[model samples]
Target: MIESDQNTVITKINRSWSVLSSNPIEFKAINGEINPDDNSYHFAIPVVFSESEPMAAVALEISKSHAVNLSVAMYGLDASDLSEDEIIDVCCEMCNVFSANVCNSFSGKNEGNINVPNKLSSEVFRYIFKGSNLERYYQAENEHGRVVIYMFDPCNYYN
Candidate 1:
């Protein structure tokens, strides 16, 4: 994709996050590589760009504490008694929402379908990140923790 297209996609991704979070969230495109924190939760979902043709995958890496904080903020849930699985589920739901938002933004471009979100091990996320061409890498931070969003093109596993 060209630079303008990349910017449009990044802007849409940022807007999607802003729409999702009750708290302020600002996403900036990163200039270099990023190492996912060991305590972070990772996820990816496949998106079909044009009627059964898979084009990309969107991934997220967010710290554990941030996941809990986001769950509370987004769902008004009590985080005090939340389990790890519950937190992961919330993150997965957020990923699903994000993917849907992105797909809608590109609706004119035949981007319509998004598959189920999958919780990924850090190792698996890293492996995919290394092998794929990253179309965008964006990071946003709040008082809770950090979140990184990855948009990869020519999705290897999906395509």
Candidate 2:
């Protein structure tokens, strides 16, 4: 991705988070490894061309506490009342929404097809990203907790 495209992706990501949570979020570009904790939740969505070929993907790694807080904010439920499955569901929906937004920005209005978000283990996440070109890595945090967004060209994986 070029510099301007990277900026657009970051802007869309910030906008998506703002739309999702009422809490204020601060995003910063990060370097080095972006390994999430073992307890973190991982979700990924593919951005596909009209011909159904994946060109890119967006992956999200959010802390467990952040996921719970997001669920409480989204569903108006108490944290203690939220189950693990409920948290995963909410996070998956979040991944789907934001990844769609980012993919639309890349493929133009209504031109990109965003696949369903998949929940994965950290090991799987790392395996899929291995040897792929990481276009950007960003970290966002607020009172809720931390979230890491990874933008990458999956096409490079098969190169």
Candidate 3:
């Protein structure tokens, strides 16, 4: 096997794990224990693919504080699960807004840069991105390819 230095994926996952393990009361929402709202935020969940077709995509829904309204799916060699209006950004650090409280969506496609449109409402997002399933939600190996774009009520370890 090949061993390389630490990377961004590892960082995001590490932070996400901390988000879950820190306090069960805080991560209870992932287990459906608590209903996420405008305050609740989702961490971890990531896409696992490059410019190629993904094997599977998994998303964690938070009832308390979720950015995307309805789930979405992208297709083709160049497709995305993100909205067309939601802001799309990139990150080099670990645990970015991708999981915090901001009301948005995120992906980890490593082929090229994935851009969400601009600022589409959740309602428009549902209809525009509607598909069978999101191809870049979260996976095992590919999960690390994602980056934090937007968030809401996130738990910052820096604090």
Predicted candidate 3 versus true structure: per-residue lDDT over 95-127, tens digit per residue: 232333211222332322222223323443233
Segments of candidate 3 deviating more than 4 angstroms:
1-110, 138-159
lDDT of 1 by residue, 1-159 (tens): 456765776677677676666666777767777776757899999877775555788888887877887777766778887777888888998888767645544323564677899999878887778777776667888776898877777567666
Candidate-wise lDDT, in order: 0.75, 0.74, 0.26
lDDT tens digits by residue: candidate 2, 1-159: 466866777777788777776665866767787655567888888777655454677778898878887888888889999988999999999888777656655433345677788898978777767756676678887665689877776634322
Q: On a 0 to 100 scale, what is the lDDT of residue 19 in model 1?
A: 66
- 1 versus 3: better lDDT goes to: 1
What TM-score would each prediction reach against the true structure? 0.78, 0.79, 0.25
Q: Of the pair 2 and 3, which is ahead by lDDT?
A: 2
Residue 27, candidate 2: Cα error in Å is: 1.9
Question: What is the C-alpha local distance difference test score of candidate 1?
Answer: 0.75
RMSD to true structure for each model, in Å: 3.3, 3.5, 15.6
Estimate the lDDT of model 3. Answer: 0.26
Better of 2 and 3 by TM-score: 2
